[model samples]
Target: MAGSEGPLRLRDWLVAQIESGRYAGLSWEDADKTSFRVPWKHAAKLGYQAQQDAALFRAWAVYKGKHLEGTDKENPSVWKTRLRCALNKSADFCEVRERSQLDISNPYKVYRIISEGTQGPGTILPLEGQPGLVSKDEDKQSPSRLAQEGSLLPATLGPSPLADHGYQAPGPTHSWSSTLSEDFSNPDFWLHVRLFYGTALVHEATVRTAEGCCLSPRAIPANAAAEYLLGPQPRMARVHFPEPPPGAGALRHLLPHLERGVLLWVAPEGLFAKRRCRCRVYWRGPLAPHRARPNKLERERTCQLLDTRRFLAELCAHLRAGRPEPEYQIRLCFGEEYPGPPDQPEERLVMAYVEPIFARNLLLHSKRLGSETGP
Candidate 1:
């Protein structure tokens, strides 16, 4: 270990060196700086020793351990698996690959740590399915070149049609006046409509009823609708509910049931419009079942809200934004109120939900947002 430093500091510096590829083929400008700044908080939650924990600081920024910490005490194997996933995501493991084909660029390069020319596992990313440690012969194959041998791939819906002349699913086609009832004054009714119509009607109705603003607008693209609904808060999921005829089958079951956090899911097709609407709901977070369905043959469960006020606050923020009567989308927020430092009351976990068209695209694009495009 380096002189005058504890084991933790030494390990952290080692991780930075590995990340910069000083021991590999390449070296980065500020890799060492980030090592201390990155994974300190995460290592604390993981219960890593001071020395081993510093290694984490050299790699990741924050840790996600609220739920997993308890589970780790009861189950060792599961904990290691979870830890492995978090640690494996460091830049040292990432490789340049063909964006379109997702194939690794180099086959001969393999990354490992060396001390007096001996191998170690401070920051290692072995090929998929193989042990985190691989033999020198196996180094010929780049970790990035390995195929996803045993991962669950998403359901392929064929190449994207949106790139063509606007892939559109027909929305409900009826005179605007025909759908609104004489006494449909309730805010909840509008909330349901927003989920199905993708905010085209929600904003229009709000302006006409509450603020009386006359705004001519076009359909709000699905993606913008969701982000707009989320307002400034970072939302991770969206939820959908069923329309009346179904008597709240799956929709009824899913509410904010988690001890903390939110839940979102796809809205049922029946609830949205007389004719099928292309819009989909993006439910945020995972919650337990509100109430089990009566006819649940397989006995599936659902979720419910833990704090209605927080949910309403986030929802209102979206509604009150400049576009009172937005044409493209409608959104709702959910929240939970937790006690903070003494004498201070603050709302936590403000989540939002919107139509799926917006939600799905946001998720797919988020991971690749700033990444440079590949030919």
Candidate 2:
């Protein structure tokens, strides 16, 4: 009677039998040592013979026509490799990898063959350490075992004094300058400023802050108040700045403070309560200490600065056309160091998001905008 049921029922029954100690000291791990006949009806329903043939063809394809010894394409070693590769390519497999925090590069660590069934192929299951594969009792103790750790911090900020040409402060209500003036020295105040802008740099920094504060990036208390401040869909725009002459790069002693600037307007519900928006100047860039050797960090900072400048310029043009929602201009000053140069004066902007997904999407959109605008 039990054999007539499908694999799901069979799995349950086998688990129960093992828990009951049906085979004396034998454990569930030893179930493969014993075999049970597959009911004829179940075998037919599963198309066992066809599945075996298909599995053999798949294994053969993996060899790319290289002749294997005999007709043993069903060899356990050969089939397992093909199966593992096939499983790894599946969407479910990727989801499992993310949830279990499994190393994507490690193929052998993910799954194991649990049973070589009598009627059909073996059953492959995620390994013991995989999240959903763990015992239910253990899962009950911690529902979200695969939660991500740590937050991200902003990579950079700008318009440096040298790059600040054409920049204009937004109107009073939406002015970041006004807010900063009230608490210019406070790191916490900067945190609020970043939250308002909600750029990728701010998001990354917020993640770092959450980790340092022992708070989950997903549920930072500071982010709760400004949740609605961010527009429903964060947008990306491109700004065009005069390109430095090819050979002039080496001799350029100083970058501009305002490459160009614009004014923006926001609806009453936008970041500012007033209808007018002003661009507030803030610097964001690599967090590495000034003493660190120049390497990829320097290159990245340069690229980010240029991109941000272009984005802001494009945004200014976009605002001039008139937008339906409240708008604000953000001035990004790129600097070489966190403390920056003595003359430049660095300002930190720390921002937080409810989840990394929102932050990631915003960054992606910005990248897309940059790409569309070209170098």
TM-score of each: 0.18, 0.16
Q: Model 1 segments beyond 4 Å from truth?
A: 1-165, 170-239, 242-251, 254-375
Q: What C-alpha lDDT do the candidate models reach, one value each?
A: 0.25, 0.24
lDDT by residue (tens digit), candidate 1, 1-375: 334742232224445555664332223324433222122222224343443433333222213332343343333323333333222222222212121121222112222222322322112233244343322211133211221122211112113311221112235433331222234232221221232222333211111111011111122345553223211112222223222234544332333221122222221110011101112212222111212211110101122111122222222333334222212232322222222345653322322222323222222332233243424
Q: What is the RMSD of candidate 1?
A: 23.4
lDDT of 2 by residue, 12-70 (tens): 43345445553332232224633221111112233345344233324333443333656
The TM-score that candidate 1 achieves is 0.18
Scanning candidate 2 in windows of ten residues, the lowest lDDT window is 268-277
Model number with the top lDDT: 1
Local error of candidate 1 at residue 222 (angstroms): 20
lDDT score, candidate 1, position 278: 17
